[model samples]
Target: MEDYLEKIYELMHEKGYARVSDIASSLDVQPSSVTKMLQKLDENHYVTYEKYRGILLTARGQRLGKLMKERHHMLEEFLRMLGVSEETIHKDVEGIEHHVSPHTLQCLQALVLFFDDHPESLNDLHAYTEQFEMGSPTDTEGKSV
Candidate 1:
């Protein structure tokens, strides 16, 4: 449902409208599925749905969708700033945005903005991670310290 809201909000801005087919294609689902979800969203007061007409989000729906999109965009930018591979970044962001709390997301957004402003700090972090990539030094008994 969040995914549908996010995509619809995105398409609304990008294309000035969203259709069941467009959402189905974007989500890789069938139009029938999109229709069902849209009805649910409508019932929940998140969207105004009328068959063969257009869908428009209510205030609450718009807020939630905008938040979802921002969270997704922020995670992607944060992962990219950390030098994450493009292939790995998208999946990671999707997995993360759904699970992370609003507070944690804010923290991550702060970190991303900080790194963007102070790229030298990000370079330092990359340099620091190199040690872990090679292998963490273990203490006695083969335990990592």
Candidate 2:
């Protein structure tokens, strides 16, 4: 349901409207599935839908969609900062965005801000991660292995 809202929001934002076929293709689902989800979204007051017509997001849906998009981007950026692969970042963000709490997200946002304000810290993070990956972890006192 959330995925449907996000995709529909993206399509509507980009193309000014969302079609069942376009949503289906973007989500890799059947048109029938898109229709079912759209009906559900309509029921939930998230979208206004009619057969053979365009889909429009209600204000409620728009808010959630925008939030989901922002969360997705933030998670991606966070993972990218960790040197995560693009493919992994995409997969991980999808999983993490739905499960993260608002508080945790705020904390993550703060962490991102911290890194932005202290770029040397990010470099240190990278170096620390590389050391661990190389199987030379630091000791309790932060001494090199």
Candidate 3:
């Protein structure tokens, strides 16, 4: 499953090899579930699963996993820029990354790049957000009252 692939990718990044127990713990699932998913992944050629040994991703699997991780990071960064909290970013990104299209992701990447080159814009945006949070009323035409 996609969750398995994501966990394997994360574990591989954190630690070299991904043990079944590690994967189970990361996903908060039982080892039996991890074993079953590993078997399926092995059959699909995404990973090499031994009975007791750890799993290793194949070249194709690794590439796909890396891409997913990158997209997750991009989503997190984009959400942070929108004033989403760090705690919320992890949950929000996890939920949206799989559903967002490549075109949307590209747009988000472009926005990130644009802000990176123009940090002042972020400050202005933050000030505007603060104005709304401070209970400043806006007129019908959308101008601050």
Candidate 4:
């Protein structure tokens, strides 16, 4: 449901409306599958769906979609900071976004803000990572030797 809402939100932003075929293509699913989901969403009041017409998100759906998009962006940024490859960031964010708890997400959000506010810290971490990868010795306390 969240995925559907998120895709619909993206389509609406990019194309001004979300047709069932558009959602199907975006999600790489069949139009029949999208229609079934849209029917469910309409029943749940998440979307206003009409046959042969585009869908409109309800307020509740819109809020959830915005939140899901933001969460995905935050996770992608954090993964990039960790030197994850672009493909991996995209794949991992999708898998991780749905599973993250509120508390964990808050921590990740803080980490992102910290890195943004203190770029020197990110640089230091990267430098430390390079040294560790090069077989630099470290003490029991994890400081470089």
Most TM-score-accurate candidate? 2
Ranking of all predicted structures according to TM-score, beginning with the best and ending with the worst: 2, 4, 1, 3
Relative to the true structure, candidate 1 reaches a TM of 0.88
TM-scores of the candidates are 0.88, 0.91, 0.85, 0.90
Which stretches of model 3 miss by more than 4 angstroms?
135-145
Give the per-residue lDDT of model 2 (tens digit) for 30-119: 999999998999999999999887799999999999988887788888899999999888888888988989999999988988998999
* Candidate 1 per-residue C-alpha lDDT over 1-145 given as tens digits, one digit per residue, 9 for 90 to 100: 9999999999999998999999999999999999999999999999999989989989989999999899899999998887799999988987898898989999999999999899999987887677568788554475776
- The lDDT of each candidate is 0.91, 0.90, 0.86, 0.89
Per-residue lDDT for 1-145 in model 4, tens only? 8889999988888988888888898888999999999999999988999988779999988888888888889999999998888978988998998898989999999999999999999998887777788898576698868
- Give the per-residue lDDT of model 3 (tens digit) for 108-139: 99998888889999887787778788899576
The best-first sequence of candidates by lDDT reads 1, 2, 4, 3
How well does candidate 1 match the true structure, expressed as C-alpha RMSD? 3.6
Q: Candidate 4 — which pairs collide?
A: none
- What's model 1's lDDT at 106? 93
lDDT for model 2, on a 0 to 1 scale? 0.90
User: Which of the predicted structures, 1 or 3, would earn the higher lDDT when compared with the native?
Assistant: 1
Model 2 deviation from native, Cα RMSD in Å: 1.8
Best-matching candidate per lDDT: 1
Q: Candidate 3: global Cα-lDDT?
A: 0.86
